[model samples]
Target: MSAPERIPPRSVTSAELLAEGELTVRGRIRDASNAALFCTVAHAGQEASCVYKPVAGERPLWDFPDGTLAGREVAAYEVSEATGWGLVPPTVLRDGPYGEGMCQLWIEATQDAELLALVDEEEPGPGWKAIGFAEVGQGRTALLVHADDERLRRMAVLDAVINNADRKGGHLLPAPDGRLYGIDHGVTFNAENKLRTLLWGWAGEPLPPEAVGVLKGLRDALGEGGSLALRLAALITPAEVAATRARVEALLASGRHPEPNGEWPAIPWPPV
Candidate 1:
């Protein structure tokens, strides 16, 4: 991370902070290697959300040192927007004049409501299906056991392509509208050593029409010029990208990646 681009903070005073103490924060609170505050904001005429590092933590990611967290966040946002799939909306990551940690936009999500309801009821039903991919449909919906087994495999391959380290079932939120949303992009597009998830069970398989369509749409939306390809070029090596392209093509040709081990790599423990 480096000094973020100079930009005005997206105000959310009109939307009112919804955190534990009315503080504007990112939407999801995570206590991983570090404690990050997540919240959603809509005060700036549109909904935006962001995550920031707490002043106190074990040790920040090497790339996110003084003045760099904001920069990394900005770059991450640029990449997410460049990619068509819905991402946690980006916001300006700024330094607080009073020596406080930074703040950014809140990622809007439909998971909060649905997850709470499902947890309270101890299960999900109807519109929800347990696809058994990574952080998707875990705990909230009944595991589809054999549900779309092959599609689950393709999702894994995509995770590998994106180098999405945290693709647990919970990370893939299926909105009521049926569109699956992917989030938690703290780690992506880095050219080297992109290993951190368990989504691909069918590596050599052909991508479903749904996935092919979405990927095609996203690539088209990216157009010929965008920060995506460049950022990836900078962080993700062309060789890696080429390898991924080859892998995708292979999967398309075969329609599935198979493992005889008879167990999925590390999908969410329980399909929601």
Candidate 2:
């Protein structure tokens, strides 16, 4: 028999990550019900670790239709990248172990000790912001905290725009290079106003000029036949895309941080 060709793994550019390739499942994240897997992808000699969530494995949600979560994750990444905040890791939709799904660059979080120290604190230290105090367990009080860093704040703005239904504290990742990454965005961009998050600290505050500029930029990119709007239409419903545009317009029109609607709880269950 003839010998099979073996391609060496190498580095890949951001644009090339989405190219067609075979994804090898290295491990499974058993904790999540959706059968999320850790995969290694080699394209053009470039090797990278990516998280893959196949549509076949996705658990059906009452509010969100089944098999659509994967696309929403990619759409969130699209919005994040378009905002120029870089809040979301590079992601792409591709065939995976189970079926068509989302593949996102894996972000290695900082040490647990550091995260524990911050979580133990009664108030957020410098460069951090306290979301609020809550009875964590059996009357044991704990404070919910988020990075006060501008990048994270930008993510908060994104959550508002996308109407993210899940922004748990643990969803925030502290990268080794010091940049923060927000993940687990499958429950986003609904036509309804469903912004549940832990970033209400900035509620009612005037939007900084820079943040407003980012919003303006996104709004322009989401206009008729705009790249972002067009991309989102493929992932989600057009009405959801219109809702995103409306939210951006609302943010610009208000010129201030958003306040909770008082209907749904502002925070997610298990804040951290």
Candidate 3:
């Protein structure tokens, strides 16, 4: 067989390409829990790689209503955009081969990026922050640590706002352009507190000044009749939208990274 078609260089308006292009499924991303098709979208002679997850393929979750994951993913992207973080890649909700689904720009992660590490030391030393300990086969344990990078810190705050229940290490993509992108946001924006993540190194620490400014902007954007609030209301339930606004307010009031509330699992199963 001939080699699969490679995507051409993407333009600055990649989101437009994803929303209006012709999407062709190239292959299946077998590792995803849900059906994640690796595809290419072409529009106006511009082609780029993307992932399409049909709403029909989403698994039912007891906590979240079925078939809403796609919209939640889009909602997360909207929130990310409002924060001006660009933490999530360009994403859109569009009809695909199977049905309506979430389409997101596919980001290539660098192989040499060392974001998470398993160290033998008790403390995380200088540039790392501890994320509790983990078992390493033969009844031994090691500390799980992630980089003390600003990108991840922004992601943590984003996760809290979105109530991302599964911020696994694999979801983080360190792009070649030195920017970090987080994917797999299907299980986010629940009405309840379900913020599970591995980037809890800054838990309980004061929010950075930059983050505070962004939060202030978010607060305004998520208020009643605000653009974000209206966008999210259409995607998620009114209750979930209110919950999201409340979470932002709580974060601003506390001015610190959120700690595990102890009501649910702090870290996702099979972390990483």
Candidate 4:
């Protein structure tokens, strides 16, 4: 078995970071979604890379309107703590020309023994592929079959709180270190919207006993009585916040395990 993975914490302050990296105003990675550049820094005479996403200019994509990426990142860091899944590590958000920008946690590579076997360069799909294991005949049919269920459930609750409407298959990555990390949290905390890609494959089903306990822990940690509730209400609408709290309460009260909902589609976009 692989040892548990850990996301290294951040200690560098904003001023220290600004002083370290050269201002290489990059725009090559720019597409419709976002515009980004890397902060190139030297450590012991070695160059290290980290990405910085600047706010979009006028006539920007509505997906990240008003430069909410920085706020969303801050919120994600906080909610990730509430989930206890440890999927999101520390990240940095800084000021930019038009709006707030962000310094994100960079992923070095994808490392999964099972996924490597399924790789086929000929038809490596649209997203990142696992090429190293294609020669070896080893892969699993389903994603995260061996994942810690309790941890997944905790993550689900965190998604609920954040209103993460886009938990797509690609967003979940299995690291070489045997840990799961969730990325792309720009579409969260709208209050009225909670569209999802995964987790609700089985909706309206009772959560497992162990999952229930974890939710209980999450709720207790997030807040009790009306204190935490008020805080969330301020960020999200009253009705939406209440509904979320109720869902948590319902999970804690029920004993049945989760089941397939068989109603909603995987992605909100129309099938191509």
Candidate 5:
């Protein structure tokens, strides 16, 4: 038997990264309930690696319709881009090995060692904020820490506006270039206020000037006859889009971080 050909990595424009491409499934991501594959995609003779999650691989959720998680993921990227925060990597919905799904640029972690250390400390290091405590294991309580970086702060604001339902620790990625990105937004944009996350350290604090600016841009972009609403409508229900607009309005009206008030837990399971 002959060995399969290796797909050489090639640089491509961001547009190409999210456009139609030749997808080759590589492997699976562990611990994910839905099917996620590591894949290399080729477009215009340029190759890029990304994470692919097909709709057909989605597990049914009581709150969301079947085969909708992948769309939700793309919807999240749309929101992120509309805000001009660029917190989410380029993501697109397209057909893949298992059927139609979302494909997002893969982000490699940069500050893993530093972040790992911070998580282990109850009083996390300076420039870090310990929001809450989680019982990790062995009767030890690990502090849920978030970086004091501006990008991360903007991400928190973005989550509030989008009503991100799950912002696990692992979803916050610091790239080698010092850029931070957020991923795994399959559970976002719900009609209900389902913003569960470990980013409560900024709760009650006034929204920073940059954060407020981003929200304003997002608000304008989501207005009637705006592009954001149109883009989101294709991926999620109108109710979800309305809820997103409402959340943005609420955030702008409050002018500060929100306090957890929902019946659901403020943090995600397996917090890390």
Candidate 6:
């Protein structure tokens, strides 16, 4: 069989294509912790590669309730869309071969896009921001750094709002079109503070003007009876929705990027 064709990101119908398309499982993504199927969705002659993670395949986590990861993935997409940055790819909850699951557009990362690096220098140089130090193999340690691009900064803000528990470097996808996308958001939207991530370079820094404006807009959209509030209510618990609203409010009040609360690990295990 031939390989699936790549979907063009410029398609205005991508969202519709994903929501209503016929999905065919091509293979399994072995590296993924859950049963992530690599599939192709087709609707009205339009076809796109996508990842489908059925709720039945989800592993039970002690902190998060079982069978809710798929919904949380879709919820993260909704919040990402509300941010106006489109940091997360187009995603939807739908039925597939394995039953109900979260299906998302597959983003192919550009081979040359370098978002994270381990440097022997104690501090990061220009065009880079330090994430802290990582212990390399063979009793060596190096500074872990990420690009100082605005795309990542926006993503950092989104991660905070969603209370994402996992923001590993492997989740950051830099597209060929110069757009950055983050994936694997199953462990998110908890009512508690579990915002572990590698994008903490701007921790405690003043929020950019653009970010502040976005936060204000989000605060309104997450209010009672707001469209976002209603949408999130179905995906997560009522307390989680309230917590989402509170996070936006807190960000607006502080007018700065959030710092690690120290109650939880500041970064995810196996950062990459």
TM-score of every model? Answer: 0.48, 0.88, 0.94, 0.59, 0.89, 0.94
Off by over 4 Å in 1: 1-30, 39-50, 53-83, 87-157, 190-198, 209-227, 231-272
Report the poorest 10 consecutive residues by lDDT, candidate 5: 111-120
lDDT to native, each model? 0.43, 0.83, 0.93, 0.51, 0.83, 0.93
Which regions of candidate 2 deviate over 4 angstroms?
Answer: 1-11, 112-128, 138-140
Residue-level error in angstroms, candidate 6, position 64: 0.8
lDDT of 3 by residue, 107-193 (tens): 989999999999999999799999999999899999999999999999999999999999999999999999999998989988889
lDDT of 4 by residue, 144-186 (tens): 2222244445555566556676775556656667666666676
Deviation from native of the Cα of residue 158 in model 2, angstroms:
0.9
Backbone clashes in model 2, listed as residue pairs: 10-45, 10-46
lDDT of 6 by residue, 10-115 (tens): 5548788888999999999999999999999998778999999999899899999733999999999999999899999999999888899999999999879888
lDDT digits (tens) for residues 182-242 of candidate 2: 9999999988888999887778889999999999999999999999999998898988999
Mind giving the per-residue lDDT tens digits that candidate 5 earns over 1-272?
99999997666776476567788988999778899999998877678889999988888889666339889889989988887778999999988778889999988887644543337765868788767876767998777677676777888888887788899888988888877899999998889888898888788899998888888888888888889999998999888888898888898899999989968789987667
Off by over 4 Å in 6: 1-12
Clashing pairs in 6: none
Candidate 5 stretches with Cα past 4 Å from truth are 1-12, 111-113, 116-125, 136-142
Q: What number of clashing residue pairs does each candidate have, in the order they appear?
A: 43, 2, 0, 3, 0, 0
